[model samples]
Target: MKESSLFRYAVVGLLFTMLAFSCDSEGVINPTPTPTPTPANERFLVVGDSGTILVSDDSGATFQAVTSGTTATLRGAAADADGHCVAVGAGGTVLYSADSGDTWHAGSCATTNTIDRVICYGSGKFVAVGEATGPDPYGIFRSTDGGQNWDRYAVTVTLRGIGARSDSQFVAVGNVSSLNDSALYLTYTTGASWTLYSAPSANFPAGAGWLYDAVGTSGGYFVAVGSDGSLYSADGGTWSAGGAVIGKLTAASWCASSSRLVAVGYGSGGGVSKGRIYYASSLGTTWTEVNPGTIKFLFDVADDGNGGLVAVGAAGEVLYSPPPADVHDAGSLWYDGVSGVANELYGVCHVP
Candidate 1:
């Protein structure tokens, strides 16, 4: 071979040898790291009319339907930190999942009354509340064994929503026989006993409307929202009035990361019902509305476990807001999410 060609071949051979040594056994050089799979506990669970249950594992970007094992209208659901999820609905139906909502099984609530809301607290303790139904209906039910069994609690007033600040502290809000008057109940012994509190007439001077939902904050505060956009707050003792929104709020949730309370419901706009979202930063003392860009009636709202909020409502409407560093920002806007089913969605929860 010519001298020039001989030198070229030698250099090429040297380069190939160096490349071989640089690669691992898989023939990959400095391979990119594989992304960690999303944990099951980070999923969002949505329940609606006709036993509709939708789960989103991708931070509300997409969702898939899951069998709820019942055709009763599911009004509310909650998931514990341990991945246990329980859903409550019409006809006193209760469904549970031990796998973070991947699969569900029916559980006995011992009543046929419609369960409007469900909440899970420390150590698998679950509490549910709804309207009084049937001849022997109890408005509240407690389950300490991950919902395998339940104990009923009798209250004179119908309870619509329940919230817990700790395993021992809880508050339930609803109305008496008439929607014109509201009722508040408190339990400090893990629901062993409950006491009714006098209504704060100053907050609802005309008449206490139906209080639909209540949420407890990490800061030891409980806020409840209800008819005519009314809001009330309690500091573990005294109940006081908070600011009102423009429409009735069916559901409310506290976002610890942002220190904001978000509520969702429906309001009349241009003679048509439209979904409404409101946020309060001053511990529910005042609220400002944020446009969710939808006309469907929103029934429930919850943290998306990704520092954002997910709301579900009429006509299977699912709305999602991006994680706003400041949720109280007036410019914040919500976008639409696909829920697949057209059933009226009533409740949503995120298991972080």
Candidate 2:
């Protein structure tokens, strides 16, 4: 009876030891958790000159042109969380897509000036910036009703790029006609008022040059890129120089999945101009250029929402980098997707 009891005790102690070894620090048994699958219905919209709008349903493997209802050279596009997209362009064009780029309809814009850039800050709020024109010549337009209608705001600078950190906080970058230098404007009142910042300051000194595009990140960082490969960073308030690249950067985007900021533009080499792309892990401290292997000028790039990137540019060039888009690929991983039209593509957005 004593030997039997000793064997049972040894077995019980061994089982307890094994169970403890298998338990996590929180005293719960650890098991492999299944990862949530990414939705397969994600869409990519690329808009460009001649009112060309292209849609890709299969992760940018192929593209088909969709009628934008007007041939006004759409320049910029943004998509909200609810699948609503707004594209802005020349002649104050404001096109809205409720069905995620499948169909588009014109929205009433108060200004006749060309709207150069547009950003959708969820909940149906969108802000667009462009060249000065119309009776007021404000250059800033805001839409609160999913871009159905807009209201213009007055600012002295010709705003080319606009980015939003929130519905009430926004930053715009462009050039001052008189100064011939870059200009920065901030609006915290939902476009009700704006504060101007320009060259000749401690943060943005003189000779800063003109800025072309701006983008806001999920981490509350804003970056504006422009002439001579210049870059500027902000935290929704203060502004500072974000270093520069080797060429002119026309547009920038934040890839949340990879935590990288990608900027696209054109650079001159051997007296021939070709597209340029650069990636930075942080705001703009350091940059690494990626050769896209094409001579076309890349105007805009957007995160694929799955750790990849899609860039569109001159001659309807559409480039895609599949998942795990490591910057170290040295341009070998980029694939030139088929965009049907030959028109220049200026803006791109991913709608999930």
Candidate 3:
């Protein structure tokens, strides 16, 4: 072949090789839309260590945290019948809000037990429970004046959380007491009395898991969650395993009817992605995940009363709000989509 022809072919081959390399070389594509997003017209509060709690009243659409001055790690929160909100956490942490998280004040943890969870029913009445530290440990405390003053009741074992089907009928759960040291604590007197109860363990491929959270619904149903996909059950008397049905039920709530249950937990083992909502009509059935998922860590979820669900969690996460037409039925913000947290969100509530 002629020298000129050979040079032309060489140039063409080099150009082709360069183009192929450019196409194959690892380079970032536009980042996939973060599954965690703020929904329009929804509200959210991001919880973190001593950081201002971020609040978004317009659904997960926008957010603002109180910056006056505070730096306590809030772990749990709940709303009252009038929509007032209360939060609790570290440093004997207890917080209250009259303007729906617009302003906050540290209440009191009653004991320095690392109060991890709290719930409010109404009439300035609230019950908060957490891990016990020293002697006379493991209990649920009551607050009558909107968390202003607390009365702590001592129990033998540690309780992770407390819930009530009514003011008189209450339930709390932790490790079930066994010769092996596993125990679960339950009460009927709104913590006026606590009894050691046994429930089915969240049986893992390896071993039984630890109980993390629990909620009691109207009628005669109660559900519990634990590590590595463990679930437990209590139907007034019997304590049985709810099974390893859901992936990670970090936070859950009873809604719709006594039969409808919604749970938000995550699967993204790395960080805060792959969050999902698992729904169950009944507690005994295995839970199934909701589709069209995003990288969201649905931590704590609640029924907003108008047919929609509100769940909050890590990474400033809130479930993006539903459509505008559904607003009335949806009721309030943070009703069903995952969101992003500047820090971490452990608790949220609507103080109405």
**Candidate 1, 239-300: lDDT as tens digits:** 56677666688888887766778888887654556787877863677877766667789998
Q: What is the TM-score of each candidate against the true structure?
A: 0.83, 0.82, 0.73
| Candidate 2 runs further than 4 Å off | 1-41, 234-237, 325-332
Query: Residue-wise lDDT of candidate 2 within 152-210, one digit each (tens)?
Result: 87777788888766777888999987776888788878876888877667657556678
Stretches of candidate 1 exceeding 4 Å from the true structure? 1-41, 198-206, 235-237, 269-272, 325-331
Q: How many angstroms is residue 230 displaced in model 1 relative to the true structure, after the best TM-score fit?
A: 3.3
Q: lDDT (CA) for every model shown?
A: 0.76, 0.77, 0.58
Cα displacement (angstroms), candidate 2, residue 228, comes to 2.7
Score candidate 1 by lDDT: 0.76
Candidate 3: regions farther than 4 A off:
1-46, 67-69, 135-138, 176-182, 198-208, 228-236, 257-259, 268-273, 321-341
Candidate 3: Cα lDDT at 314 = 61
Q: Rate residue 126 of model 1 by lDDT.
A: 92
